[model samples]
Target: MPSRTLSAMDDHDPLTKAISPPPDETAAEKEARVKSELEAKRVSDAIDDDIDKQRIAEKRGPKPVRVLLLGQSESGKSTTLKNFQLMQDAKAFRKERSSWRALIQLNLVRSIHIILDAIARDYYPSSRPLMKDPNSSSTSPSVSPPSHAMPLPKETYLDPELLELRLRLDPLWKVQEQLARRLMIHESQWKEGLHGGREVVVNSAVAWKDVFTKKMANKRESSDSGRINWDDPTDPGRVLHECAEDMKRLWKHPLVQNLLEKQNLRLEEMAGFFLDEIDEITSEYYIPTNDHILKARLKTLGVSEHRVELNAGGGLGRDWRIYDVGGHRSLVTTWVPYFDNVDAIIFLAPISAFDQVLEEAPKVNRLEDSVMLWSSIVSNKLLERTDIILFLNKCDIMKTKLSSGIRLKDYVVSYGNRPNDFDSAASYLKKKFAGIMKEDSPLPRTFYCHLTTVTDTLSTQKVITSIKDMLMRDNLKHSTLLL
Candidate 1:
C-alpha cells in the first residue's frame, strides 16, 4: 500500500510559500461573522415569507372576470342584475324580494304626493304653488297630458274610500318626505366620477340605518295618536293589505281615473307599481319570484354588485363579479372606475325611447342620448378589448307605444312616416344602433344584439343563456384551471 500524502511544509519552499493555512479566528471577529450570517439568513427568510404571502393572496382571492353593466337610466340594468341572481343564486334573490315591500309603500306614497301636487296646482290659481314640490313623481314624465287639464276641486266627486286611502297611507307619505330630505343631505356627500362614490337617492334610502326615528321628541303630547310605526319590522305588508280595499276603490273611482287621464298619468308607467296587485303582493308570507323581482321598477340610484360562482359541468366554476352603475345623466359620471379591468360590458339601449326626452334635460331625446352614449363607449380606447352586448330593452313598451300612435317619425324625423308597426319600428331602432356601431366603434368587437322586454323571462333567459355561454367559452380558454 502506498503511504498517505501529508501537508507540505511551507517554511522554506517557494511553492509551499505561495499557499497559507487559514488564520485562527479571534472571538470578536467570529461573533461579527456569525452575526452577519444570521442577519443574511433572516433577510432571506423574510424575503421568502413575503413571496409566500403574495402567492397565497393571489391564490385565495377571487379570480373573476369582472363585467360592468352600462346603460342610461331606465334601461333595465337593475332588472338584468336580478336575472343574473336568479340564474346563479336563486335563494339569495328570493330573500331580497321581501324587502321590496317598503319600497312599494314609498312608491304608493310618492304617487299620492304627485296627485297632491296636481291637486294643489288646480286647487289654487297662480303660476306659483303652496309648496315648491321637491321633485315630480313620474318615472318618465316626458309626455304631457292632452295640453288641456280638466277643472279640479270636484270635492263632491272624491270618494270616501279615496279619503280613507289618503289618510291610512299618510304615514308612508311622511316617510317619503323624510327619505327625500335624508337623500338630499347625503346627496351632497356624493363624489364625482367613479371613485366608488354612492348616491343614496333611491333604493339605498330604504336601507338607511335608523332612518325613521324622530330627531326631537315631543314631550307635551299625551299619546302618539297620529304616529305610525313603520319601523315595526313585521307590519309593512300588513298595513298595505289592510288598506287594499280602499286602495282599489281609490284607483277605480271615476273622478280619480279622470284626474289621472287629465294628467296623462299611468302609475304602471312609473316605479313602485303595486296599486293593481295589492291583494296578491300583500298576502301573508308573500315572497316574490324571479320575474316579480325583475319586474320591479324603481328609479334606483347608486351602483350594485352581485357575485356569482359560475358552473362548469357539475362543479362550481370561476367567480364572476358583475357591477350595475347608476344610469342617470348625473350618475353617468360615476361609471368610469368600473370600466377598469372589465372584461365584458352589457349596454342597454331603450330603442323606443326615441319618442321620449330626458327627464333631467327635456330637450335631449332619450334615444339620441343612448346613441351618443353608445358611440362614446364603443369608441373609448380604455375599453378596447371589452366585449360589447347591446340590449334594445323595453320591446314591450315600444310595441305598446307604437300601437298607441306615438309615431317614431314624429320623434326620429328621419323616418319620414315609414311603416308604423312593431317590426318596422324595432328594425329601424336596431339599424340605428348598428349604424352607430359601424361608424363609431374603433375596435373589431363582435356586437351581440337582443330585443328584450326585460320583464319577459323566457325570451330574456334565452339571450342571457347565449351570452353566458359565450362569456364562458371566451374567458375560460385563458383560465385553463376552470373545469
Candidate 2:
C-alpha cells in the first residue's frame, strides 16, 4: 500500500471493473468474443453507410421550379422559348440553327401563300357566307362589315414580266407545299410534351428540295452571308439570281402591297421576307440568323419544356426550366397537368391583337379572349400561389398596327377613344389584365410585368436578367434553394 500505480488502484474502481476485459478463458471462449466484437463493428459500419446514403440522396436530386409560358396563339410564347435557348442554351441554338433554315423558308412560303390567298379572295369570293361582326346588331345577310375590313392597298396585277417571273419561281411553291404538309403531319401526330415528330422532320427536312442542299463550310461564316452565294455553287443561286430583279419588283408592286393591306398581313415579322433580299434569303446555302429565327413562327402544337442549367447568379448548376405551349384554346386543356407545381407563369398578351379576332374563334375579339383567359388563370385556385408575370408582348407590332389605323376603341369598347397611341392602348390592356390578378393571395404575390418585343433580344435579355434577379431574391426571402 506504499505507492499504488494508477492501474492497480483503478482495478478496484467499480466503473473500471464494470468495463474490464474478461478473465483469460478457453480458446473457444476467446474466439466467440472475437466474433461478437467483429459483428458489432460490422453492424456499426452498416448504420454509417445507411446515413451517408440518406445524405447523398438529399443532395443529389433537387427539384426544379417550373416556369410556364402561357398565352393565346400567336402571342409570342414560343418566341420567348427560343430566346431562352439563345441565352441559356446557345450551343443548342446553334446546333438547331440549320434545322431552322427549313422553318424560315416555310415562313417565307407562307407569306407567298397569304398573298395568293388575298388575291384569290379579292377576285374569287368564297361560297360560304362570311361571318358577321360580333359587335354589330345587323341581321341582314347582305350587310357588310366594312369597318372591320382591312384597308385595300393600291392596285396590282399579274403583268407580263411579273407573270413570267412567277412561272420561273413556281417550283419554290411546291417545295413550300411539301414543307407545309410535313408540318401538318408532324403537328397532327404530336401530343403534350412529345416533340419526337418535330425532331423527325428536322432530321429529314431540307430548306427547299431541288433548290438547295447543305454545302460544307464553316457554319459560322455560312450563316452570316448576305448574298446569293453558297459554299457549294449549286443551282438555287442561279434560280434566285434569274428572278432577283422580278422578286424586288414583285415585293414593291402596288398589287402585292394591296394584297398585304387587304389581308392585314405583315410578312416582315416572319423573317421579314423582303423581296429586295430575295437573293440572300433564297440562296442555296442560306443559314438563318438569330433575328430571322426570332421572326420565325412555327405554330406550336403542344407543350415544349426546355431545361436550362443557368450558368451563375441563379444557384449555379440549378435547373431553370422554361415551358412553351400551344397557346390556342383547344391546346389549353393540356395546360392543367403543368399547373400542379409551377413556380411562375410568363403570360404573353399580344397588345396588337386588340382589333384582331382569335383564329380559333372567328367572332371573339382577341383582346376580350385574352382578358377572359387572364381572369381564368390569375383567379385559378390551383395557381393562386404561383408567381404570375405578365408580358404585354408584340409592342412593336402594336405600334405599327395602331399607326395603320386599327382603332382600339373599335374592338375594345372600353378603350373609349382616349388617344389611339401606344401608351394609351398598352395602358388600357395593362389595366384589363391587372384587374384579373388576385389581390388577396396569401402568398403576398407580386405582379411583375414588362412591355416586350421578344424578338428584340437586347431588350428581352434585360427583362430576363431582371426576372432572374427577382427570382433569386424571392428564393432567398423564402429560403428556397438559393445558394
Please tell me which predicted candidate would have the highest lDDT against the true structure. 2
Distance from true location, Cα of 113 in model 1, Å: 3.4
**Candidate-wise lDDT, in order:** 0.60, 0.61
lDDT of 2 by residue, 179-247 (tens): 444333332221221100111122112222222223322332243332223453333334444555655
Query: After superposition on all CA atoms, how large is the RMSD of candidate 1?
Result: 18.5
Candidate 2 has a TM-score of 0.68
What is the Cα-based lDDT of residue 382 in candidate 2?
A: 75
Runs of candidate 1 exceeding 4 Å displacement: 1-62, 125-234, 297-302, 313-316, 472-483
Candidate 1 has an lDDT of: 0.60
The stretch of ten residues in a row with the least summed lDDT in candidate 1 is 190-199
Residues forming the 10-long window of minimal summed lDDT in candidate 2: 191-200
Q: Candidate 1 residues 391-437, lDDT tens each?
A: 99988878888898878888888887789999998788788888877
The per-candidate count of clashes, in order, stands at 0, 1
Runs off by more than 4 Å, candidate 2: 1-61, 89-91, 126-166, 177-242, 269-279, 313-317, 439-444, 475-481
Candidate 1 TM-score versus the reference:
0.67
